[model samples]
Structures are given as C-alpha cells and as structure tokens.
Target: MKKILVVFLVIFAGAVQAQEVLQAGFKLLENGQFAEGAAFFKHYLTTQDATNKTALLCYGRGTGLSGNVTEAKEVFGKLLQRYPGDFEISLNAAEALMWCKEYAEAKRYYEKLLTEKPNDFAANLGYANALASLFEYEKALVFTEKALQIQPSNDNAKLSRKYARLGLADYFVKNQDYHRAAPLLESILSENATDKEALFAKAQLYIQLERYNEAEKIYQQLLQLTHGQTEVYLNLSYLSFLQANKPLAFEYANKAVESTATQPQKYLTARLGRITALGWNGKFKQAFAELDSLDSVFPNNNDLLIKRAGLSIWNKEFAHSVSLFKKSLRNVPSSFDGNLGVADALFAQELDDESKKYVLKTLEYYPNQKDAKDFLAKLALRHAPALTTHNFISSDKGGNASKNYQANVAFDVATALRFNVGYRRREVSNSLENNSANVQTMTAGLRWRVKPFWLITGAINVTKLEKDGAVAPFKTFDIASEFRLNKFQTLELRHNSDVQSFTAGLVGNQLSFKNYIATYNLSTPFKVGVYSQYYYTKNSDGNTRNLLFASLYYDLKATPVVKFGINYQRMTFEKRMSRVYFSPFLFRSYEVFGVSENLNVPKQKFLYQVSVAGGMQRIEDEAYQATYRASLTLGYKPSANIELTAYSLYSNSATSSVVGYSYSETGIKAKWILLKKQQY
Candidate 1:
C-alpha cells in the first residue's frame, strides 16, 4: 500500500528532524518568539516522522501558541498514544487546552497528569481555575488550598486561593446567603482595598442590611473608581429618596437612566428609582405616566405593579388600587406590598370585612407588620368603635351658676350598631343671686349601619326646667342618615327637635329651635380635603334661619407638618331667628371668614393648630357689630397609637345676641389606641 509507505516515510523524516532539533536544542523555538517557534516546528513536522515525540511536543505547543488548540490537541494525542505516560508531552497537551480557555478538556488531562505528578504546582493551580470556571467553588477551593500548602509563598498559588474565595462568595450571594458571603468578601478587601468586585459585593450587602450610610460611602468610592455603574447610581438615588431629598434623588436617578449599560435589569432598577423619586416629589400624574411606560417594558414584573398599586392608593383611587394589587398578587401571591396594599385599600373603601381577611393574610407573611396589626384593631371596631365626649361650659357673665356640664360614653351594642348615654345640667343665673332657671336633661343615642352604604342614627333627650317654682317638662328627638360613599367621602343629613339642648354652651331662657343639617366630607391621608354644611333652623317663636358653611384644607406632601386652609360661613335669617326674651339676644344675620393653620413640627411627636375668624353680627334690625373668634389646638403623642389633645376657643363677641360679649371654651381629648394581633 502506497499510503502506508508514505506514512512510514513521513515518520522517518520526523525522526531525522528531531535529531536536527536536538543538535540545535530549539535555538529558534526556545527564544519565546511563538510565531517563529510555530513555523520552525511546522517545518520539522513537514518531512519528519509524525511519531517523533520531541518534534510532536514542540508542534503541539507551537499550534496552541498560534491559537489552534484543537489541532494542537490532535498533534499531542498522536505522541501521547505512543508515550502516554510521558510527563513533558502530556503536560504540554493539558497546558495547550488551558491556553485556549478550554477549561473542561484541560481539567480532564490535568486529572490524568495529577496521578503521574501529584505534587505539581502548575497542575494544581490549573485544576483549581478549571473547577472555579465550572462554578464548583467548593471543589476548587480544595485544590487551591492544597496548592498553597505545597507552595506557601507562591504568588500564583495565593492568587488562585483568592479567586476560589471570590468564586465561592459569588455562589453564596446568588443563593441569598449574605451572612456566609460577607466574611469572604471582607477578607478579599482586607488584602486589597481597591478590589472592585469585593467592594461592589460589600456595598450590596450593606444595602440589603439597610445600613444605607455605609453603602453610600462605598458607592462613592466605586463611582470614583468606575464611572459607568448604573446600579450604584440607582441605589444612591434610592437612598436619597429614602432620606426625602427629592431633588438629589431625581438627579442621581437621571444619571442612572442616562447610563449606557446594556443590562435590562440595570435599566429597570434605574427607572424604578426614577419613578420613586417622582412619587416622592408629589408628581403623581407624571409618575403614573412613567409607570405606564414601565408597564410596557416590564409587563409582568410584580414590583412595578405593586408600585403602581401604591401610587393608586395615594391618589385615593381605592378601587383601582385594589385592582392593581390583585393583579400583582396573581403573579406573586405572597408579596408583602401587594397583600398589605390590598388590605389598606379595602380598609379605605370601608370594606372592613374583606379588609380583615387580607390583613390576616398579610400578618401570616409579615407577623410583626404595624400596618396589619393596626388595621386588624380598626377592623375589630369598624361596626361600632367606642366613643366618649365630655363638655363643661361656664359663662363669663356670671360664674359657676350660669354653667352647663355634660358627659357621654358610647360602645358597640351590636356588630352593626352602637349606643350612648349621658346627662346634662344647665344653670342660668345673673351676677347676683339665683335669678334664672335651671334645666336638667338626660340623653341616649344609637347608630346603626343598616346597609352596606347606609347608616342610621337617632338620639333622645328628656328635659325638665324650673324657674320661680314653675316646672316645664319636654322631650326632644334627633335623627340622622349617613351615606358612606367611600373611605374618603361621606354625607349625612340630621334633624334635631331641640338644637339648644344639643348645643353644649347655650344655657339660656330662650325658645328652642328644630334644626336640619346636611354635611358632606371628603377626606383622605396626605391630601386636600373639603367639608360643607347646609343648616336650617325653625324656632318655637316663629323664627327661621339658614346657614351655609364651607371649610377646606390643603396638606402639603413634601412637608406633612403644615396644612393651609380656610373656612367660609354665611347665615341668613327669614324671621326672628332668635327669641331669648329675658336676655338682650336676637339672631338676625351674620357671615364669617376664617383662616386655619395646622402644624406638626419635624421630628417631634406633637401637633398644633390655630384658627382665627372675623364676622359681622346683625344684633338689631339695622345694627351690626364686628365679631372676632379664635381657637388653638395642641396634641402630643407620647407613644404609638396614643394621643393627648387640648383645644381652646375664644370669641371677641357673641355674634348671635343683641348684646356683644366675649367668652372662652376649652376641652381636652385623650385617646389610647391599641393594635391587636390577628390569627391567620
């Protein structure tokens, strides 16, 4: 066979070239000129015996150096078959594969070579890198450790060990095992302060732990070292947002959004941070628009949907908020934000029965959540929470004789109802002697949620008045219907047969009036609110009056401490609206203009408010007096859910009387709210 003979001749020629290379002792290839070395080895292979071990070894090394690892492996395999146990040739083959970054193939040869030269430093280090590349850090560390023990002061061994630790740390981090990953990352940074990998890991670790100040410090260092880190910018922006620095948060978020990183997750984080900054700045419309855009980019992301739900809740769109929360729960059923948002939105909508279910669900996942606990407590009292009221009024005209005092307490009579009982004593007297009548009254009241959206309430009072040994007995009725449109909106219509009996400070020898009042309130947290009332009264002395009142408050989002508001009132008389025969009092017509200020100083558990009003009082048919009134309210919250408040009002003149006089009234309100634990 001619082909067999040609192979024999090639083998013979390779052996001759090997003899020549031995005489030359690799003069051309030994100088580290890899191109020339490859050419010289190829020239030797052209006519030499392919089975020549020396020439074959040189050829594999040359081909591997020339970046043809597969060909190099083939050349080495030929010689390895003939001399499979030769150290020099086998190591060359493994090293060639490693050079080409074929780590898995190189690991195989290294395994075989280790049996021959078990203590070889190069083999151990190479094997460690191979295992690390395969993400087998646990196994890789074993090899790295052995390499270090064999060569204690070797830089290559130390580098391999460090790499193994970094690889293992990355592994732990991916598994969310930050506690195990932290020490390894710190060890790397301790040796090299500028280790970017370790620094980034450490910074993220701090972020997860909520050690934000420390994270900020490391991120600053990272910025100086690496200018193109999108996540760092986004994280810093989030930190700014948490600190309530809206402008700074927006600035950093813009930087992250402008980054050129190709990672979609990086862009997602940046955009999320930007959205948060927008929300913090009170840019709800803009934030919602941007959220719509984010929805297109991340259609199924639970975090974005939860964020949208939170914004909806802030906007007082409870129905929409619940919808978004439900969608988010569809994807991540146990998400803390999603579940809690559902509970809160339901509570806001006055759907406490449904809210209770979700609140318990939230507590199942997050047992120590304050919001859930607080909501549970409120849910327990939703149908009929307890209520208490106390009133003490003493006139400046006389002293304790012209005084009225009342106290009442109410609690749940049933799931959908409540009941209250109280008694009031009124003494009318002048500056000298007991010259006026005294009246005593006992009152009872009840409220019932007759339907999902309807509430009915009624009150009854029995009164007995004595003047000059003559006694008059009378009974009064008060009833109302309430419409609970949503958590933020309500409407009520009430009618009272004796308005003076219900008015805390009015202790006069005057005819009583039957009053009808319609009140509307739309209020929510961290928002502007409006309250309006239309009141009509008809007195026993054939007098009728009508009053329209409007009050509004705009609470600033950025500074929740301050609220700006105003109140406007107009009163119109149709007849002799007041009939205090013995006193110089007659209600004709009046109007009021008032400004209100509410303040809760930053970083304090105290709240305060002041309101001042000026009005024109029509005391006589053609006479009027300038009436001034002011009020102060102070509140101190000593602990969670407990509050103490004091309120005082001063009037420059009594606007409803023919005689102008000033009076002061003060009251205190204390509340102890307790959040209860609920079972899932």
Candidate 2:
C-alpha cells in the first residue's frame, strides 16, 4: 500500500508540473507573444508526454497565431484523430481549419460539433467566424449572438459579433439595400463612433445614395484616422468628382497620391484616383501618361484595364475602349465595371442592340442593379413610340399675323429605322383685302440609320389652302441625309419643295419654292465650333435665291451650356418683288450672340435656354440698320415619358422685301411617350 501511494504521488507531481508549464504558455499567448508561446509549448512537448490534450490545444493555437497555419492545422487534425469526440481538441481542430482558410470545412465541422454540444461557447464562436469568413454573414450574425449569449462578457465573441454585423451591412450595401444597411452601420458607430471600417462603409453607402454632402462629411471624419489617409483622400476625390467639382476632385486626388501611406494596394488605388480626377479636369494627356506608367507596372490588371477603358471612352476612342473592357471581362467575366463599360462604349458608338446585350448580361450578374436598369430605360426610350404637339402665333410690323398648330406621332419601327406621321393647321391675315389665307396639312415621314454615322430621312406633306373663298390642294416633300463624321463633326444635305407661307401675301399668291440646303458643323475639343450653312432656292415665279451663313462659337461652360458666337449672313435674289415675301436683290448681316442652354432636357426635370443677339443688316445698298434678336425656352418634364415646353422669339433682322422688318412668335409644346415601355 505504501509503494502504490508513492507511485500515485509521483504521477500527481508530474501532472502538476505539466499544468504549470501550460499556464505559463497560456500567459504568453494571452499577452500576444504567440511565437514565444509556441516555443514554450514545443519545448514542453519535447520532454513531456507529447499527447497532453490541453497542451496540444495551446500549442496548435500558438502555432497558428504565430503564422504557421498549415503546420498548426496538421497538428490539430492529428490530435483530433487521436482523441475523437474530445470537445476541446475538436474545437481547436476546427479553429485550425479556419486559420488555414478552410472555412467551408471548418463550418461543417463546427456545425457537427454544435449539433453534439449545442451550448459550447468555443464551437459557437468558431462557427460564427467560419461563416463570416465564408460571407454567410446573416448566419454568422446568428451564431455570433449565440456565442455572446453563452459568454456575455467575452471580448473575442463581442469583436466577432461586431465584424459579423459589418459583413452583413456590407452585403446589404452590395445588394443596394441601403435602408437595411444604414441602421446596422449606425449601430456599429453607436458602439464605437470612430470605427474606421464602419465609417468608411457608411460613407460609401451615402455615395451610392448620391447624398454627396453627407458622404463628404463622413470622409472628413475619416481624414482624422491615421491608418487609411490615402484611402480617405481617394474617396474624397471621388466624391468631389461626383459633385461635379473637378478642381476640388483633382486637388483631393493629388493629395491622395502624395500621401505617405505605404500599403501597396491602397497606393495603387490612389494613383488610379488621381488619373481619374485628371481625366475629369480634361487633362487627358497627363491621365494617359500616368495610366500607361501604371500599366507597365501591373500588366493586364483588371482595375487598370477598366481605368484605361474609361479614359478611352472619354477620348472618344470607342473601339479601343470596347477592346480594353473586353480584356477586363476576359479576366473576370462577371465584372460589373467590365460589362457596364462595354455597354456604355457600345452605346457611345450607337450600337444600341450590342449595348443592350451587355446591359442584360450585367443585370444577369447583378440582379436588380439600379444603374443597369436606368440605362436599360434610357435605351428603351430611344426605341419607343412618341407623340408631340407644337403651337405658335406670330405677328410682324407689316400688320401680318399668323397662327400655326402641329402634331406628330413617331416610333422606331425597327432597329435604326423610324416612321412618323403629322398634321398641321395655319391661319394668316393682313390689313389688305384678299390677303387672308387658311391651310391644313398632313405629313408622313421615315428615317433610317443606314450606318452608325449616316442617316437618311424623307417626309411628304399634303396641304389644302383657301384664300378669297378659293381652295387649292398641293403636295410637297423633303428629303435629307445626315453624316456624323466623328463625335465633333457632322454634315447634312437636304432638299425640299414647299409653299412659301411667311406672310399673308405670299400665302394668298400660293407661292411655292424648291430649296436645297447644306450644313456642316465642326466642334473642337477646346470648346470652339464652326457652323456653316448654304441655301439655294428656286421660286415658282421664276426667281432664284442664294444664301450663305456661318457662325464661330466658343463654349464657356459645359453644364448649363453657355456659348458666345459671331455670325455672318449674305444673300441675293435673282429678282425682287416688293409686293411679295422676302426677296432682296442683296442682303447682308453680321451679329454677335450669346446663348445659355441646358441641352440634356430628356434626362432632367427642368430645361431652359436664353439667347440674345444684336447686329447690323444692309439690304439693297441701304445704310446698315441696327438689328436685334432674342429667344427664350423653358421646359418641364413631369415624368420620364412626358415634357412640356414654352418658348418665345423676337427678331428685328430684315425678313421681307421691305428693308426693315420685325417679327415675334410665342409657342407651347408637349411631348409624350406613347408606350410605357419598349416593344422588345
């Protein structure tokens, strides 16, 4: 009995020594001296029993925490095999799987362990982390709460719960459920107001919502964080860009590029932001230079490819843009930027069907994506049926007045082909007897885009005229072809046979004209443009007219486009008939004009333009007379498919056989989409 007691005492002493060694190792691990803890446990294992379950668990954790995850996983896996169903060993094994990034397997193992021990804190927390790693954030959150309920004061469990909440919020943001995302982020901020990840996420959510000012505020808060200065500045630059403050954008981007942040991926992103900001500022050469330099360093990188593609689009290099976007798609076939970039590039090139294909593909990859749906709606508008009405009344100093009303229905009958029909009514009256006329007209038209850059259109008009109780029916037609040489150049040629109805006298005479016109326009990248027009007319009274006009303009701004221009006009008539309409032996005019317009009427709720010009005109060798013209148009779009506009114009330039003439007209117009959606 004495010998047995001594043996048992010896075993007890050895076990106590082993427990002390384990406590020391755990102390090292708790202090984050993982490498030292690993060495301590390893030394203990070398001389002691190698299979002490608690010692093995601590060693595996230390090894994994010290960055030897593969070896740690192997060790824990062997320990699990040797001690099957041992809860601590099983939990360590699962954690090792996570350390090795075997998240799915770890999740499965944790699930099994939880089924066996539903209330085990370690298993619940480990499974929560594994699920979070797998981006199963909602489930991860559930398990995180479970772990928290088990150990309400466990800081590790609390941290895991925090990160799970973050992950779930990010998932919601990615899916565009901003309302759901916002509350979660706010919850995290409520817990720790300076949490960098939560702040950044909230800023991005505001950006997605286009609450730019709020996003700017968040970014400003982020600027106080030391760890991600470059990222903060990069986002600030992007936000500036979104706000249409190009100079501020460039300034922020430059700061981002010059920041001392050393993270490689972040540095790369800052450079890209600088390049994009440069592009926004119209510094294309510098942007391209920077892009090329970066491309040489990171060849075929998807983000670089996308940036280059965007620059290509900005430079009007559509084909090259498409090619670069395709290269990005080849790298990541489901890349949202690649698919959407290709769609936009194709749309810029007027390849609508091709653009639609990629847009649909984008939607396929990201269901219910708002940008894709909006783009699809814009595309649909182009192919949908539409109706329009225009009404105007005019009066001249010669005691002549007229009223005109017109309506049209138009639709794209097929890809690149359109058909339209219209009707018009006009009434003219003057002081002289037998100088009153009324006319009714019907019209049909067709337009076909034979190529992306070329289009042909033709219209036929049937008119019934009545003057002094006499009625005359006549048919007239017009045909035109337009060529878009490039983004900034266009040419149009047109010929028309029409009744001359500028005045009551002309309408009473039933005068007709055959007119041929050519127009060419060229816009430069420097915001300068030249527009020229030439006209030749043959009158039914055996008279001919020739006219030439040209304008040179400079754009002062892009949004709410403002332009100032100088215009010149020269004209001659083969024969002058004073009693008739505008038929001068010689006419010349020069003017300087300024105009401000919001040209994106279809995309916005409000549109407007104001134009004014003052100049001098000479007719038939008379001394030059001061001339002035002004026009204003305002439009309101109540919905996506409807628009209402009102306009007024007044001109004192010579427009009649008399040397000086003045005219004014005012009108209201309405346009509506006939269908709520496109046929396709």
TM-score of each: 0.60, 0.89
Compared with the true structure, model 2 gives a TM-score of: 0.89
Per-residue CA lDDT of model 1 for 1-680, tens digit only, reads: 00000000012345556486543425544454555666776776677655556667766766666667788788877777888677767667676666667778878988987887789776776777777777777898798888888888877666767777887876676555779989988888888998887788788777766677898899899888877688778778887765657799899988888884655557877887788777777678899999989888778888898888888887778888999999989988888889888988877766666777887898788665655776665566454334444454545442323466666666666656778787878766655444666789889999787775788999999988776777768789999999978767899999998734322224344457798999999886557789899988777767677777787876654343444566665666665423342122244434344444434433347877776766675544647767777788888877544557778777756542222346666767665433344421
For model 2, the local distance difference test gives 0.84
Clashing residue pairs in all predictions, respectively, total 7, 0
- The best candidate by TM-score is 2
Native RMSD of candidate 1 (Å) = 12.0
Positional deviation of residue 314's Cα in model 2 after best superposition, in angstroms: 0.9
The C-alpha lDDT values of all candidates are 0.69, 0.84
